[model samples]
Target: MGSNAPSSAAQLAARAELQGFVQVTDSRAPLYARLAVGLADDTEAVSLLAAAPASARIPVTLFAAIHDLLLADPSEPLAAWYPNLVATPRTDDPVPAARELCRRRRDDLLALVTTRVPQTNELGRSAVLLLALAALGDEMGPLALLDAGASAGINLIPDRLRVDYDGHQVGPGPLALTCGVRGKAKADRLPSAVPVVADRRGLDLRPVDLGDPEQVRWLEACVWPDQTDRFDRLRLAVAEVRRTGVVVQRGDVITDLPAALAQLRSGHPVVTTSWVLNYVGEDGQRAFSAVIDDLGRDRDLTVVNYEEPDLTPGLDWSAELATESLSVLRVLRWRAGERSVEYLATGHPHGYWFSWLD
Candidate 1:
């Protein structure tokens, strides 16, 4: 039987047993995330967190520490584990063996109720660019668009709202945006062509169906708590998505991509995911790149990737702590044989940015 219900004592016992679980390094996540998850009542967060593999349990344990030390006793030094946690190096790690006995307990925790969440990650860039295209080109007219890694049909609703980019803005409009940098972008004043949106479809091997309320709610909770802007953006995006009939289907892109590409209208622009690429691993990235290289040469495609540029170790765990989103994201624009530079931005889960790609 699945462990989908646990008494309060069972939960506390589990936490106590795993008390030794501590953050090894602050490199992977920020203190706030640690605090939010670690210290916040596990009775409240455990259900959602339990969905993650046991290998992820220690992170949850350390998260509890953040709550205990920061919230419960702010004046007390977190010295016992702070520096050690931040300085410890990362390697292939796993949850302590003790977790195996908590299987049923973990299952029980995952059954909690959650909020409705929309599509997230770099796939969000596809819609962001469409707005940029209209805002920059001075056209709101319908534009043909396509997306890869369309996890759920949700991202297919990119054209339904107004957007503000780095201050200079546009939209179906009135969308408010705040940025960390200055210099108002030259945007949206012109009568932008109304996008005669001919098409918007996506491909994903394991596409999530937003139509399912429980699953959608789980997706919402999966969203990092600190990024409230993301929550708002998702709210707007989902509202539009609910009104549309955009479709997504199950299929491996490596084998089915050419066929999917064939469905796009000629001369129309295509956009794919920055977040999906990170999950593609080494060979998958090369193969996908090769496919795009061949297809992009003859098509008017703009692949906007809001992804990490390299595998180098250092990263801003602070933003991760704050928003549960990547703070520093490199935007890559690839078309034909050439790739041009776009500025890096601190990303939000919902599509807001503090920086710009200029």
Candidate 2:
């Protein structure tokens, strides 16, 4: 989570410089605006927000992502992405203005990158998927879980908040999964996992520590304003992390997988991630899958992912851009040579969706 208060003038400058690059890529601006705010770097963002007051309506967390995206690679789509944002309608708050800009530029960027990258990882998908994994373990016992792009480790605390499905209920709170399942199933089998035993952890290139109030707020600001449950879930997750402490190491996922696995019990099932792998390039994807494959061959392993099902690389302008609805969530389970997959849900990467997997 780092310090929400930008650490120094130099750090703020670096973050702003990163935002400048992200804004160039229409896909990156909404997030860039938020990260610029979160890192406490965007004075223009702050000033704009103060005047517009649309900050509450904005997806502020995207800014941090924009910072990361630009810092990682600053060419191609981003150059066009930034200006697209400038063309978007400006609201009272800098955040929404930034988000609208991203939305406006999404089509152009989608054409630019085609569908090579995934756009979002909303908490609703993560919540259901984790519950499903826990239920799957009801058949195989509990497992050790590792997440990539964990961003403050919020998803790791899925058990801490409440989840409901139709008439079924689960969680430390009362929230439930509302998506309709294909077949009639017994609600009794749903997970009633005690928050205590879930061995959860994650790795993020920029791991956000939830212990800090300011950092937590920035994460809070990232949630869309319309979803009250999402906000509640995020708050519960932060509280859980603060109370129980989470194992979120600050490092690259590829380099850290081996060590992360070493910490898990040998027989415990290993679940990799949800909506985090898409940011990685081809080589990194292969290396990561290879690591997971090796783990499955030698150790108990399962991969639960909620990523865009389509990987079509060419430019597809016909597809709708800007919203997270384009992304589909899928789960992968490993066993020897078999790679089992099930489509679970779909929505904005960070927006809302129904889950049929539970």
Candidate 3:
């Protein structure tokens, strides 16, 4: 089974690109990236991560997630090495340290990534939703949000979070996500307030329940180990969700689209998919696009879509997708049979900051 491995070199390369991208954009994540890159020739690491390629193709995300789990659980030995535990961590070459940690707990770590998908429920990205809602203008009146691949469905309630784009503020709400404005973002018209979300619902193949301690732990695991601020944000989002529960159903997005759309009660129904479509096959994605288009033909449906340019079709986007192979945020609308898709911003997968694309 050495040469007949399930995870092809291309899958490993995708993990590399994701790691390299994160290594550059986020200072805290470089350590994890280094460990991921170290696995290029390390047989143990490769075999451990790609035990089941279908689930492990995106090893970097999965690995980071498990680290989140181990780090949070004080009983795990790796938790001692976790930088967050001690204010001043032993930061001298984290790759070797990481390898040692994995070597020590090979079975447990292997078991974690083999089953878990790259489930990052980043509620911080709700800022992008606010931007999309603002782009629609007040004429759309109230909003009805339908989130695909919504994970824990915390992102469905972006209005409940505050967003700040380089001091251009939005929402006097619960959570605050501040992003540095860059490139065309400085010139583009940003949102001053969170849109009025009258109603919301989310669809995920495996919807995570925040009320469940185990699910909450896995969600925490999905977050990168280095990003303390993100972890804090996750805690806040979890609390909010527990306080006011969200409606997230577990079902196939393609098959569930009709029923999901039918559930929208009032106001302009806006469908938003952020980083979720990447998991769907090309055929599935085409079908997903077609479904939205077909629905738009009859009613006024606005779709806010964001995905990695590499994952999107007909995406002759900007330098981020072309050069860096990054995530691009887009705002699209179909009203009275007229449709428009616009690239609004490009940012890290975890929403550190976004360059507004005018």
Best by lDDT: 3
TM-score of each: 0.58, 0.57, 0.80
The runs of at least 3 residues in candidate 1 whose Cα sits more than 4 Å from the true structure, single-residue gaps closed, are 1-107, 110-128, 135-142, 173-195, 265-267, 311-350, 354-358
- Measure candidate 1: CA RMSD: 11.8
- Model 3 poorest 10 in a row by lDDT: 314-323
Q: How many steric clashes between backbone atoms does each model show?
A: 31, 32, 1
Which tens-of-lDDT digit does each residue in 276-342 have in candidate 1?
A: 6656666776677667667666654555444453421122222333233453343234545565544
Q: Candidate 2 versus the native: TM-score?
A: 0.57
The residue ranges of model 2 lying beyond 4 angstroms of the native Cα positions read 1-122, 172-198, 226-228, 311-327, 336-339, 342-351, 355-358
Give Cα distance to truth, residue 352, candidate 2, Å. 3.4
lDDT per model, in order? 0.45, 0.51, 0.71
lDDT of 3 by residue, 259-292 (tens): 9988989868988888888778677777888888
Best-to-worst ranking by lDDT? 3, 2, 1
The TM-score measured for candidate 1 stands at 0.58
